[model samples]
Target: MSNISVSENEASSSEPENKNSPAVIEESPELQRASSSTVPPDVPSDEPPDAPDGGWPAWSQVVSAHIANMISWGYGTGFSVFQLYYKQTMNLPAVQVSWIGSVQIFLCFLVGVASGRLSDGGHSRQLYATGAIICIFGMFMTSLTNTYWQILLAQGFCQGIGAGLVFMPASASVAVYFKKNRSFAIAASGCGSSSGAILYPAIVQFLMPSVGFPWAVRICGFISIALAIVGFCLLKPRELHRVPAPYLDLKAFKSLPYSLFTAGSFLVYFSLFTILIYINSFAREILGLGDVKSVEFVLVTNAIAIVARPIFGFLADKFLGPVETFGLNCIALGVMAFGWIGVHERIAMYVYSAFVGFVNGGAQGLFTSAISSFVPDVRKMGTWIGMTLGLCGFATLAGPPTMGAIVDANGGKYLWAQVWAGSTIIIGGTMVLISSRLVLRDSAKPSAI
Candidate 1:
């Protein structure tokens, strides 16, 4: 919240931004053992650090970050609806329309590596502001695009990159502030993403009818501008120490358990967007549901996830180590994937959506903590977070269209798509189980809490 103007010279001169420079991710004695070497993988016995005195300010930071991240989520989700509008109004092919969404998802995660490094090196506000500007530009560009590539470049690539920039710092800043309730804070941030899925689709559906596509997109653009300002004002680093930016750490690959964890995360993340974006269309075409009902189903699923995410986080903090928690959730997620087997009627659809939302939502809560636990060097957190998410981003990039391709391959049916998604999720759970055990066994037990 401080009006700190970080100069480019200040950032660059401070430290050479590279991973092999030196060790920066400092941890408590117990944390070092739990993550670095052989240690007990149990929750620490001591209480967390006390809450800051200015309760309102602390709460504001969380609220503002949530609003900013949610807006980013809305930007991406809204773009999907925009693509649907283009297909309907401009007569774009399904395959071509698919590229717009693919590019957006890929660009969002790909650009995050740079954004994460910037945040780590004490230029969060500047980097975040720049990202927001790009987000706004992407929206404005969407209003102008008529061809598929234009939309892909503008709405997909540009918007995705911009939103990606906003997302990492906003979420990471929240992590820097609260240590004890990190899971809850992250869950709240995740809720913002879910809210975007709920509201943006409706916004597009409602506005496209009344204002038409161009103006409707403009409305979304203005919304991004407002969100950027609020986020820019609230963003700050928790501590003032200068840390080197984390380039991708190849040493992480030396740890086979870490590699498996990353791989499993990739599989789960890849199936997520594909399911979220295409489910409504599947409900309408495959199950013969109405448009309103189809949209409501998506909203309901996301709404349930909002609560599930936080609750899962709370449980992880209290009862299990991050890796164990992640593994458990993945198992539950795999079980819930079976719920989608025969969702024919309206009642069945709602039930399936609710269960899947809870399971998948909880899985994310576990995933974030798991990554943090595996990489306990808080100093280099931004880099590790970026690297892990960037890997997940690769999954997200492939997820949507792979499912779309499956749908196309199945003569436009989601039956095979659902099967493929469920299989991937189950495989993710299997990997989580094996990897968590390996991590727990290898970690060194430290003396201090």
Candidate 2:
């Protein structure tokens, strides 16, 4: 009787506790609601996270993009030497020789359109590695070419296609890792252009006589191989396959600021490459400078821009703002183009080139930075950048050749061409300025742009 009473008392105590505690959670709606997770309808779970703006991983991408910028811009910088060489040796007309350069630049930007989309789909490494190989192969094959057709296929088609592939993807990679200092990072990457410009001209000028044209080009190829290896090693893609958007983001053109900025970008490229293409020739033919001396001026132009480009970027990030800074640069480039008309004396020409280089280099460095001014979503960066630059390809293709033909038609006088370049750039600057005001007043997050 005592054991039975004890067991029944224990069961009665445990039953009440279990019924009160467990039944509260199971039967009381308020308790059940408190325990379960309930997400608000407005908040999205799949939004992209914010960038880790200043870590080793972030900075490493800048380095890789720098290497990419070096290769892409480096080869273009040395083309003047080849231009002079091909003209003298092959008996080709000046306009015909310039087609090679125009075609090369056109393909670089053209191929970038497709490759940039590929980058958005997370093919950066594959595009980069393949571009490096193809570019290096084109360089080697260029060394063996004796005819214009052969050179055009090897250098213009293959190498230009390769440059287009690598440069955009690497740049797009850098765009993802930064927010606050994006303008600075993008501009800093352009310092690669200065490095390549200096090294390429210096290499050809000093080594061509001793090593011959073939071996000098081969040496550049060797250096390219080394940089390509380093670029592939450092590059890391953070974003994976994005749900595909329209091949052409036609909706982007609906925005007033986007349209104006795109037009400004086009006009600026039209005027900008004129200086790079003809500066050496002007120094050689009009000023009576020898081969080595004229080439030295080209070096001077490239070297000063290295320091100037970064300073422009820093100012855009900290003080002036990117679009505002770009507007100023376009105006300055216009004045520089006009100023070129007055430079006849050798010493005066040297001073003028340094100044022009500073302004022009700053402008090139500002390009991607300025575009970032209006781009709100980081995910769409590769697509937007590609579209803008690819359109600018038409300008680049048409710029140098058109200017060369104008000079040729004007009996070798650069006066008319200079006027056209200056007028177009200043007009472009005005459009950009108007666009800047519209953006600052209307953007929901004005300061972020």
Candidate 3:
């Protein structure tokens, strides 16, 4: 591990003399100079700090991170296939069946603090290696389980924790490597989720009927294993200035922008997974689509995301800036939520899926890059992101089951669920707009809050 350095501009510009005043500084050339200077000492000074931005090492890391993203996020995002399968095969209530997917998402966010802290402490590779093994083991165990509890422990809890460990570190590493094109780099890595989304559902659809559930799941597990190994070899992080504190900075809430941003993230996630989890079921139960056709809804949504991610990333970098882009995308997501109410016919469903998928990909893919802009020191990024995401984890935990209860109470109609999802996302979008205003107002003096 190499020592880290903070440029004079970054060190001097990070803090405000007046505690109550917003730190707004001019967007000077110094800011750009300081950005690359924050890299660890091991990077050669002769080569442009942004060299690896397109160079093989940087792209290789992105590719590995993409693989990890595909394995972790792909499974969680496409859990609808399994959800529909459980509904038909198992004698469980909708609420009980929803727990498996909910728990998987919950642990993925909840473990962020620990995993991020570990990465900040220079344990990134170890965490990724351990996570890969745990995730592979969980998937293999899932294939062997017949009971709900067994699957919950193996697939939901075990795999979720492993995925979190892999994802957080991989995300943090990309920030370390790219400063000028950070959003685009992160977006490129994030496309793996969309790719997984495109491939996994189709794989399950083909495999489940031909080979049955156990083999279908095991085959996915095998694919995850191969990807994880390659990702583990490629993913690397720059050394930190120092190890981060074991505890989360509760004082981070004092920053108005950060507080509001976290709140908005929490609210957005409250209904975020609802569509992904239940869209296939909605098509089958509400729209009268066949099993295969219903699964295609998931495919279409994720497939559109593949193209949308890079476009949004480019827009974030070149025009809107990450915070603005994220807020605007959130608004688009809210509008698309309303579109879901009209999705009765096949054409309407596909249209809604494509629009929502585009917006959702932009919002999610740009999230980490947006947050990174708030940090003054890249060394503490892992801790800040972990704590913020950990707070949002509760929303992921509660959202699905609450929606399940609402659907059950309404006699299986999706009207109330749509209302819940749309209203929360709209509110979340408003919160993000407020945060963006704070960022814009304080743009003159850039302080990593």
The root-mean-square deviation over C-alpha atoms between each candidate and the true structure, in angstroms, is 8.9, 14.8, 5.4
Cα lDDT tens digits for candidate 1, 206-321: 77768977887788778767777887787765654664544776666666777888888788777766666776766766788765677777787778888898887776555555
The positional error of residue 440 in candidate 3, measured at the CA in angstroms, is 2.6
Can you tell me which runs of candidate 3 are displaced by over 4 Å? 1-26, 29-52, 444-449
Which candidate number maximizes TM-score? Answer: 3
| Candidate 3 least-lDDT 10 residues | 36-45
- Tens-digit per-residue lDDT, 230-309, candidate 3: 89888867654664476486766766777788899889888888888899989988999999999988998998888888
How many angstroms is residue 177 displaced in model 1 relative to the true structure, after the best TM-score fit?
Answer: 1.6
Residue pair clashes in candidate 2: none
Clashing residue pairs in candidate 1 are: 37-443, 37-444, 38-443, 38-444, 38-445, 39-443, 39-444, 39-445
Candidate 1 lDDT score at position 111: 79
Top-scoring candidate (lDDT): 3
lDDT of 2 at 159: 83
What is the lDDT ranking, best to worst?
3, 2, 1
Better of 1 and 2 by lDDT: 2
